[model samples]
Target: MSSIPIRIPTASIYEELASARTTPKTVTSIHEEDGSILDYTERSSDGPSMPPHGLSNQALPMDKLSRAQLIAEQYIKDNKLLKAHEELIRCVALSKIIHGDGHWRLAKAFADLAYSYLTVRGLPVQAKQHAESAKNILLRGVDMSKSVEEKREVLGTLVTIYYTLGMSHLLQNNGRESYVSLQKVQKLIADLEELQEKTSVLGKISDKDIALALGRSCVLQEKLSLAMNFFEQAVKMVISSEGDSSAVLIGIYREMARAEQMKGRHEQAIHYLLQAHSICQAVYKKLSEKAAHTGLLLAKAYAAAGRSEYNENTNKYFTESLSVYQIVLGADDPQTQNTRVEFSKWLIQIGKTQEAYKMLQEAVGSETEYSETVAEMLSIMGSIHLADGKIQKGYQLLKKCLEIQTAVYGSQHSKSKETQNLLTALQKSGASWE
Candidate 1:
């Protein structure tokens, strides 16, 4: 049997998450390897911070399969996804030779290949094809199995394949299909638990993985509260496993913050955002693009948090995050421009119309293919102009913004309606365009 420890799903897990208070985990500055989240500190960590958890069928010898899987994983970490895909293909061929066709081991190889295609290579079509192949192979294995335990083991492998399929759908923006696939996986897990009578369903599937995937599906479904519960449970699982919290908890924290933000729980959102920032800072490269992305997320969260309670830290976070985005993403990048727009809007909110106007001017001058962002810049600038007593200038700018919005989103779009209403109000205020 493979020595890989797998997490099994159970009803108590969901029950606990549903009933527990949602609290951001306390983060410290030290790398306490005991699985606690650490402060955001740049480190010289070797290899990828998040490596794949080795999983395969128990029937295969662990050493050879593990070796190939590790090599493929390293390729993925190095961003050589094509190489990773090739390596997995080789592993799949080897598995077919050693474990024969229709074996669960071969099914696992196919599943891994599908994951590489879906996530690394961004080939959803190929990913779905391979996921189905894996599922069909695993189903055949389960049908031929004689013992209940054997059937359960094959089902566990299917759960992983189903997850890959869900990811494939998600990658293609088929959220409803993704949710359906995830639900099927959950049902399979439930069946396995029932058969085992609450015994650990820990085969090749982790409850944390399932929970996180389910959380993502719920997010697609707009069930923010349920999503947060699942994300919290996933975080708890990471801590309990003595795993590196930085690797696992960062994404969970970010998603949890998003859910809180959607629910208008700005304080809670900021808490989770801080936790995500802290974790990303702990292990992520200081000047890496990943750090910049995380900073951007924190910036938006800080801005939202400030909307409810304007604090110095909100400004501090925005300043630091904007600096990082500017340096790493460059002045012309859409995200950097977006960050500038956000900062300018914040400045306007705090009665800094002149500064906001200058900022928006700089942002609007930048060339971008994103007309939506351009429209946003123009609107903010118009608002700043209005606040600064330039009624005619604000009127022209608002009318221009409305035109851009209507062109991009059509006249009947909600965004266009908003701009139209704003322009009408400005006109009613005697702001005339000559």
Candidate 2:
């Protein structure tokens, strides 16, 4: 029996896919207001169209598809995410033209495009839409898959679709939906593992990635113990794949620290934070923002531990954090100012009000704008002065704080009302402000 020859679709199909109003819309539509696709394709009106390798209309759709996929991968490797996103959009259109809308191949194309939207463009809503579309197509394709290889391929695509959907839900803060979708991903990965199939669908995602995401969703749902379990699982996976000194462990350690802190295991939290801080100091520049942030977390953990022995450690980390922030982010940067404010608050808590007041004074003096940070510093400075029996200075600072609160929060806001009440009480205390 002679098998029928498969005829490839002509360039006319590519033209229709390119020009038809009914074709899958590019993901750039999600950010059309920002003009992200300045020169995306032949349909782009803003600038000269960038056909794949300057291919003409006569180019075969399959050829264009292969080129688009290759270019997209290259763009991703080069960290040109926007360009990659554009090529992925082209691949989606070309895939539909080559393999009809319901084919598993098309579903795989949509899944790839969805993942690109999520990771490359940071557009979760678009990612969710494309992933759902892929899921619908895959559901039909899975039943039609005949060979074991075809079934495995469909399952791989399903895994990617579900994973993208899960992450998109997580990014949108829908914890329950995120957990459900991620659970499906976990089951699918297990199935693939049982089949002795390498998970090619998990290009950048791994068992550790799924575990970490599950832990985060569990954290959002307030399931502390379960979250810690998943976090520890992630830590173990990372340690097994990459040694303990791997920089990836820093984020996992921080997440574990947060979970411990939430569970009121302060010592455990401090232990995790110390590990993360040490990793940051070794992997990143000591004065880098990453190291400074880790130091800040460690300092906060020490302060929250509420032990006298940890006070020196707390102060040391706080000072280091603030100095690093000042040196790296500049003194006028909001992060630097925030670190200074946090350090001052910690100082006041430890009965170092004079030092706290001086730090706040320097911060306030450098301010060019009346921001919420300035208002907070002023309020704290006023309270410090009042506690020290410097009524005149306290009154002046309180008045300035009140003015800023009124301007920032409006006269009827709770903060403004509170400041107004404080000023009124000061006046009743016989403080003349003529």
Against the hidden reference, what TM-scores do the models get? Answer: 0.62, 0.84
Q: TM-score for model 2? A: 0.84
Clashes of each: 1, 0
Range of the 10 consecutive residues with the lowest summed lDDT in candidate 2 = 1-10
**Local accuracy by lDDT, each model:** 0.69, 0.81
Clashes in candidate 1: how many? Answer: 1
lDDT score of model 2?
0.81
Candidate 1 has an lDDT of 0.69
Q: How large an RMSD does model 2 have?
A: 7.7
Scanning candidate 1 in windows of ten residues, the lowest lDDT window is 1-10
